[model samples]
Target: MTDLQFQCTGVRPEPFGAGPTLLFGLRIEEADHQPVHAIALRCQIRIEPARRQYEPEEVGMLGDLFGEPDRWSSTLKPLQFAHASITVPGFTGTTHVDLPVPCTYDTEVASASYFRALSRGEVPLLLLFSGTVFTGRDGFRAEPIPWHKETSFLMPVDVWRSMIEQYFPHTGWLRIRQDVLEALRRYRSARALPSWEQVFEELLATADAKGGD
Candidate 1:
């Protein structure tokens, strides 16, 4: 078995991706100065909400998620953020690699809600790692990645917001049920609406007229 240590150096949003994605820089060091054949890596990221202080407005924005700040001691626990994997190329001593994590804007996701509630500051994160480690000189050997392997990183909230802004740009995403989709389609067809925006704008006007708030 090879003695390996993992460290999360930093994270940044991908300039271009099919969806909002972040690239986390990871460094893997092999003790005893041995050569590594390759590593099959899996990382589970978590948000540590209790690790940082929040501004008054941020606390208000997060009330729905965590309730009043007074109850945060019970509610502000760790939340699973993202799951990512990587295949580390062969290296000796130490090597660095990128772990790409795709993100969602859907408010239904606790991680998404946690991220959106923040106006500024870093998000404390814990990266729990596991997988198979392969190494050898003449013949290859396989070893289970230690369960205790983990690293803590403070990710800048600006990076997450920047990725979403680049991808959405003055837009927001909504997730609705299939029944609601059918209803919306029927309403649009009945009104001969040219686009979903028109359908929504008309609906908003109707709601305003009815004082629906």
Candidate 2:
């Protein structure tokens, strides 16, 4: 059996990724001076909403996710952020690796929505690690890394914001049902709306007029 320790040092956005991606810096250490051949690491990251305070505007935005601030004591639970995997190469005492975490801008996702609601602050995260560890100096031996092996990291909100800004600029993502999308497409075509923004503006104007009436 091997005793292992994990730590999350920092995070940064990866620019050349296919989509939005974040690279988390992780440091792994073996308790004994034993040689480690490699480790197939599986990491589950979670957002601890209750660990930090929220702003007034952010509270309002988060109502959909965690309900009102008054009931947040029970509702502000952990949200699943991402599942990342990596293979740590051989090391004797300590080793460092970059855990690449893929991200989305879709606000429909609980973690993404929670992240978007924050104005300025660090997002508390818990990284749960598991999987197989290969060791033994003479011959290779495989062992299971306990699920209890975990670490916590506070990621700055600006890191997320800057990543999104780099990819989407001032845009946000929305998910809609196929039927609803068809209806919107028809409405746009009928009104000769050149852009989706114009289509939304036209719909908003119509809704406002009806409300006034």
Candidate 3:
């Protein structure tokens, strides 16, 4: 069996990607410095909230996901961030590769919600690695990578913010059902609202007036 080890060096935003993506720099090493033909690697990235501390503002925002901060000792658990796969070319001793992790801005996602709650800090990540390893020089041999093969990384919040800014700029994203969207559209059309911003402003004003009365 080949003794393989993994390490996460750094992460960066993919500027030209079709969607929001983070490319994590991964380093792979063989203890015996044996020749590796190739590796079909699968990685599961998880956000470990318990690994880091949170701010009051962030805690308030994360209430919907983890409940009150007082009970966070038990509520804080690993949040699944992404699953990525890569095919590493043949190498000897050691090699480096980029693992592309696709991301989403949908606040409904637990990972996204946790990310949004953070003001400024690194996101604690636990990367679980698996899949097949191809080795041997004369003849090809396939072996299953153990589930215990994993690594941890600290991803900067700025990297995530910059990636989101590249796509959404200063705006945030919201997902609504088709029926609810139709109703909003109807409301906007009835008032001749020029933009969705005005529609929301008008609705808030109306609610405020009702509350005052």
The per-model lDDT (C-alpha) reads 0.92, 0.94, 0.93
TM-score of each: 0.91, 0.97, 0.97
- Per-residue lDDT of 3-108 in model 2, one digit per residue for the tens? 9999999999998988999999999999996899999999999999999988899999999998878899899889999999999999998998999999999989
State residue 205's C-alpha deviation in candidate 3, in Å: 2.0
In angstroms, the error of model 2 at 101 is: 0.5
Estimate candidate 1's alpha-carbon lDDT, on a 0 to 1 scale.
0.92
Structure candidate 2, residue pairs in collision:
none
- Ten residues in sequence with the least summed lDDT for candidate 2: 67-76
Top candidate when judged by TM-score against the true structure: 2
Clashes of each: 0, 0, 0
Q: Across residues 89-172, which tens digit of lDDT does each residue of candidate 3 receive?
A: 999899999999999999988999889889999999999999998998678899898999999999999999999999788887
Model 2, stretches more than 4 Å misplaced? none
What tens-digit string does per-residue lDDT give for candidate 1 at 65-147?
Answer: 88988899999989989999999999999999999999999888889988998999999999999999899877889898998
